[model samples]
Target: MATSVKSLSNKESKLIMAHMYVAFTALFVGATCGLLQTLERSGKFTLPAGIGYYQILTVHGVVLGLVLTTFFILGFMLAAQSKTTGGLNKTERTVAWIGFWLMLVGTLAAATMILLNEATVLFTFYAPLQAHVVFYLGLALVIVGTWFEGFVMFKRHARFRKENPGERTPLLSYMAVITMLMWQIASIGVAVTVLFQMVPWALGWVETIDVLLSRTLFWYFGHPLVYFWLLPAYMMWYAIMPKIIGGKIFSDSLARFTFILLLLFSIPVGFHHQLTEPGIDPFWKFIQVILTMVVVIPSMMTAFSMFATFEARGRELGAKGLFGWLKKMPWKDARFLAPFIGMLFFIPGGAGGIINASNQMNQVVHNTIWVTGHFHLTVASAVMLTFFGITYWLVPSITGRTFTKTMNKLGILQTILWTVGMLIMSTAMHWQGLLGGPRRSAYSEYVGNADTAAWGSYQIAQAVGGSILFLGMIVMIIIFVNLAFFAPKGKEEFPIAVVSNKAALPPKVFENWKLWIGVTLALILFAYTIPLIDIIQSAPPGAKGFKFW
Candidate 1:
């Protein structure tokens, strides 16, 4: 899309608007799925035990995890890349509309297939239950829609770089390119499945395929896909965390490196998902585990650095005592309230995630609610929370409307409910998992084992907990809907353009090769996983296997 260097481009506005609509839509679907799951567990909802619930779960995951994220990030990068963006011409505007509509159609079609029992495979496509041809075809188109963004962003950056030769690229643009690269690579597996594997199978040309091969390919893409979901949230954190907490970012250099680190480490670490799966082996597991653990290094550095930045700002603001900086912080504006609560939710989730990422501890928690809890802590608590907050912060620029101050406050309140509710729900599931209630089951019907009855109360607790989560989701959707269609247009205190009012930096750092090389080396270890799992799953009970990382 051609954008003038003088004003905000149509692509950016569309992306922002699309982001809002998709984000709200996802919240709506995910919340509904959550309600059903809760109802099923409560033994209260009178729904049939069939494809509808499973498909709801499936669509919820696909929509929230894949569909909504792609649109949001694509829009964000496109909008952010223009050095001088003017309003789009009709052709460019039409492209934006096509991309958005393609994504929507794909999401809806995929949802329909999953709902109708045509695709019984879990959202992860854990293995074998194939969906209708339309499902994979629809999904392929969604990915294609996003690829259009790559074309637009690259051209825009090229134009900007040409005009400003020898200037370092902005960190935001650098991350955006890497995200595109990562997404392209990540999409290969899914693309192959759709175009080569699943599509043919659904067409009845192929009789069967390798389940292990397909599942392994899925994880290779799947785990990295989570980071794809996370990068935008991370960008927000690195960019906004300090501003919200009353500090400057500890180091722009560190944020740049962290983005690079994400690219380097995230792609190769997918094998860690296969540590217990049949497709991968022990050596690969060891290698993957090492990389997976190493990933924490940069991540921890980020946490420490962000905290230091907070302290620096706090001291400058005349705050005193160990945690007194938090006291002086503004607690009312949704922009501020959302992230504070998001960070509050992250500490425990990060801790639990460490357990899942561990080599040995994973055996205890794998395929159980512990794994579920760990992710809920990350996704529900951290990623989704930040997304919601940022949307609140960005709403005015995109919609030209201000949400009700009370509803905005209520949104903050919903975050509170979700925080407490997820804590209770996930903790209950974690405890139940230790008792061995299997994951991915329609219901946790533990038979006759002492551990089964032991977890009953915990399962019941989740019913209550999930109900609270659903309520929170309802409140959130209401808030977003009101803002989108009903909120009065107000003078935006900080328009989207003003959001990045800091002095312009050159855009040369984007071409840095060091970051690319580092990521490549770190990911090499992923190759070892499949061999490792095959060896270990066969070992007798109480046996340990050797490995090479």
Candidate 2:
């Protein structure tokens, strides 16, 4: 019983619009900082010493990586839940609005500190670099807000199950719940680090902090944070892409299975991010690396399923040849092209992920520009592109408008610009990384040094790519503005792909969220317990915080 576009209540529409507004505004601010960083690194532009490169970097990462992704995903999920599951009840809606405002206020507070140069610690906010107490407090509030929203979603889904005991949860709603569940579990590591470690240290309640312990906890939350960005994009791929392309989901059961596996495996693999770090046991790191490798299985399954669906649709559309089906796709549709281009970038991005997760390979590229390249490809290109694609129709749907022809054409161009920019920037970054270019540093110092001269050219390329990306972002914002405010009023359909009739529903076990949650916790404990204990036991004397900026 999907809710029609016209059926949306004013409250739901306003809430959804608020979420999107914050998300897009963050995107604009973050992308501007990103462009400045790229140019600054290339020695093409320089900021005053009062506003250091690291400060801008911190703002960029927080706004884009943490704030934008968090707000957008929650908003998107709320929209999906409303459309598919009869909208949130009054209590849930009230709570959701509260959460949104808390997150927004916290974001503003944090951004103020960053802009004031009081909090130069990067998004990881790794220890030894202490920020203003307000920064940590703001981040804590954001996380708490998200938790409140996650609770509402979980309760809503529980009520749905109670009402329809034997039926499987709707695919979109099911994925949304799994995503939030994994986030709640995965966020615990960072939450503990912030609430107990960083907050005390920042407030001067503690003289020094345990650097290793803090980092260990951060990565514990950090790696799964990738999945938090990714699963939402995957939801669109699995549940909505098929409909846009005139096909049903390949298998609803398999989609649910993939999400379940993600919940189980995503958290335990956090240690893979620590492969090159000391203090943690190499053996435990090895175990986590294997676990990280195992998580790839579900992504591979998704790839196969999506390709099969695309192929079937292509054949039905009368396309011939092995690769001709790609041509048969709705190439002119910005919604499809944006995400499809993102998928193309992910082919390399995912491969880079495998490389980064490898014990041997990670040593070569740890903390290098290659790691940046990989994440940009996945999170920036893949995840953000999909988010942009969703905005194409999502804005119009909530506003009771349709995209202008000019806006749709601009959307397509924006995607192309983004794709091209990412390829250029990421390729340059990868090559420069292999040549020993360090990440998270102002590299302009080496511009003319003969020893590091090779990196200069790539830096220039990166700047060019970044400029193009900024352009694309501006265009995207323009398109959204037009659709949201000025476009002619018309009906815009919500596209929720159907499950193929031939595909049988999974066993009831697949829908047993309680069972899967328990197994997921067990796996996380098995993977993290020993290493975390060892780190706590062997931690060196605490570090007195520094404010380098």
User: Which candidate leads the pack in TM-score?
Assistant: 2
lDDT of each: 0.67, 0.87
| Candidate RMSDs in order | 6.1, 3.3
lDDT (Cα, tens digit) per residue for candidate 2, span 1-549: 333344367799998889889998998999999999999988878786667899999999999999999999999998988888888889999999899988888898889999898899988888789999889888888988899889888888888888888877888888989999999998888878888888888888777877887888888889989999999999999999999999999999899999998988888887788877788888888888988998889999999999989998999999888987988999999989999988888889999999999988888888888888998999999999999999988888888887677888999999999999988999988987776778888865553233566667899999999999999999988988888788878778788999988899877887777799899999988988887777777765554222211
- Which residues of candidate 2, in runs, are more than 4 Å off? 1-7, 445-453, 541-549
Give the TM-score comparing model 2 with the true structure, all chains together: 0.96
**Model 1 over residues 70-148: C-alpha lDDT tens digits?**
7666665655454233333455556766777777888888878887778766678653677889988888888777666
Backbone clash tally for model 1? 23
Of candidate 1, the 10-residue stretch with the lowest lDDT total is: 540-549
Query: Per-prediction count of colliding residue pairs?
Result: 23, 0
